[model samples]
Target: MPKPGKHINHKGRNRRFTNPEELEEERRKEEEAKRWRQKRGEVSSEEEEEEDDEASGGSDSEDESSDDEEGKKAKGVSNLIEIENPNRVQKKNKKLTTLTVDVPPEKPQLSRREREEIEKQRAQAHYQKLHAEGKTDQARADLARLAIIKQQREEAQKRREADKKAKEDAVKAKTAQTQKALGKK
Candidate 1:
């Protein structure tokens, strides 16, 4: 009993086992295709074997030929295309492994405490540098001291000028008094 709407062949089981002659014809067609490929310079093992046999001037035995034919049939159309092992190919267009000095290596995974310590050290160094330049708030006392020293220097300069003017005035007065006394005498 055949399934509904299914095509049945009362002669054979399925399309694969249909006609032995049809299978043989299909095998012949495959051989013809192989011959055409050979003409186009695509060589297979079977073709190579036939060439070797011809070169050696010896005929292959029936069993060996049949085995070779069976092997070719087993390989089928899949073997027609040449496939290269991807690993075997050295790709010129592949992205190059560039070793650049500019790119820093990955930092080692540090603990939170260690990272914070490093950050603190860097900040301390930065602040210390700024403090040395009198740029940080911590250097305000030093700046104030500098300002005081400058003010003191300016006061000392003024005092020196005043003392110099007084000495000059006294000398002028004494000279004028002596001249007047000499004239009067």
Candidate 2:
């Protein structure tokens, strides 16, 4: 595949735009953009050119009628009025990108140390949340390991007690036999 030509530069070296489907795709995208602008009550470049023509004092009957209709349309809808429906799922409203200038930032209300402490707490919470996700499985494994170790220790303790008891009983028996042998009889 050859590279697409960048405007007038490298013309013969490129051949990607030669496909009919690519040209149609580009054309369709442009048409869709024009439709979107019109739906948003925006005047496209073509409309702008027509407006310029009317401003130049074109005596066309259709242009004059449209101008009169535009004035009537403006009077029908107030600029201060808006339809606010919080439940409606729609695209973002097209309005001026306004930002509040008088709103104070957190920097004025909070000290630097306080802000840092809050950030540290937030970071700790996030870390704890991530650790908790894997902690359940790790805790189960640790408990199983501790149970095995405890059982082993208990078994060893029992074995030591049994050996001690056997030694004590054997010594008692040997002493009894020795005492009997030392008797006057």
Candidate 3:
């Protein structure tokens, strides 16, 4: 049975996206918000830690002795690896660094042009850095042109040197002819 105004059967769109990446991103955002709340003292650290443990599928009470042994072994291995490679420690720290910066007082509002200029400068700098690394589209496109220009310059330099040598050889021949004529006289 259905109402007169409503259809008996209907197709409906999904409420949530089927994309796994989007779902993972949403979860990450929620975790970041929770961390921020904990930092602001709005949520208790103990509760958040418990939630984190549950999310990680780890238990505090069960296998406590086994967890301790595994933790110690992992710590020992990590220490050895870090001692062998200092760069790895820096990289691990970089991933773990939290973006929990202290809020600064609001400054005077910038004009639209000023904001645009700052954005432009930042973009230019980013492009320049990428260009230096030969990672930008423009840099890739310019590589052939740069090589051609370099070849042309080298050819021009070689031509100039050849012309200079020819002139010097002609001058030497002229000097020898004049000296021979004087000797004959």
Candidate 4:
């Protein structure tokens, strides 16, 4: 029976392309194609080889000696030019670049007015606090005295009401006796 989707077996039992050499060659070709794509994108082993080649080729000893000789010749030409222009005066720049900040001296002593005002305010606040404490103590004492007076007045008023009630009861009993005598007549 033929399987679907390009004859690769679902059970993986049948190998149609039977040569092992052809299979290995096909795998090698696939890998080589992948590497070639990576190299074309500058991201593979061949690209790294080219970079190593360029770095090794650019720094030969003959190129280094020629660069050193050119540098020495340029320095010698500058020195010769400066020696020939002997009368050319190098002007000194008069512009100030660095800044010097002037700091004020510290004062250890307070002014007389400030010291006097501070002392005066301190004394005033102290006296005011003492006066307030004295007033508070006096107010508490007055409240205690007033409470005693109110209690005494309440006791006296109660006693007066009791005495008045007793006097009314005595008058009522006396009137009942007068009524009895008048009824007997």
**Tens-digit lDDT string for candidate 3 (1-185):** 77787874455754755799988999999889878985765665355456756766666634553454454423236656644555654434444357545768689899999999999999999999999999988898899789999999999999999999999999999999999989963
Best by lDDT: 1
Error of 3 at 51 (Å): 57
Show model 4 residue runs off by greater than 4 Å. Answer: 1-135
Which 10-residue window in model 4 sums to the lowest lDDT? 67-76
Q: Top model by TM-score, which number?
A: 1
TM-score, cand. 3 vs. native: 0.33
lDDT of 1 by residue, 13-92 (tens): 54555588898999899779877887875667757677557665556544565676665533456667877787895856
Give the residue spans of candidate 3 off by over 4 A.
1-125
Q: Residue 96 lDDT in model 1?
A: 55
How does model 4 score by TM-score? Answer: 0.28
Clashes of each: 0, 0, 0, 0
Instruction: List, residue by residue over 1-185, the lDDT tens digit for candidate 2.
Output: 45667446566684655689888999899768766876776654456456556576666746665664565324345655876889988887655557666777675578889999999999988767765664656656877898999999999999999999999999998888888899833
RMSD of each: 18.8, 19.9, 27.8, 21.9
What tens-digit string does per-residue lDDT give for candidate 4 at 1-185?
67566677468676576699998999899768766865565344444444445666745645654554455324236656655477888897665655345757777798999999989999988877865675666656877898999999999999999999999999998888898889953
lDDT of each: 0.79, 0.73, 0.76, 0.70
True-vs-predicted CA distance for residue 69, candidate 2, Å: 38
Q: List the candidate 2 regions with Cα displacement exceeding 4 Å.
A: 1-135
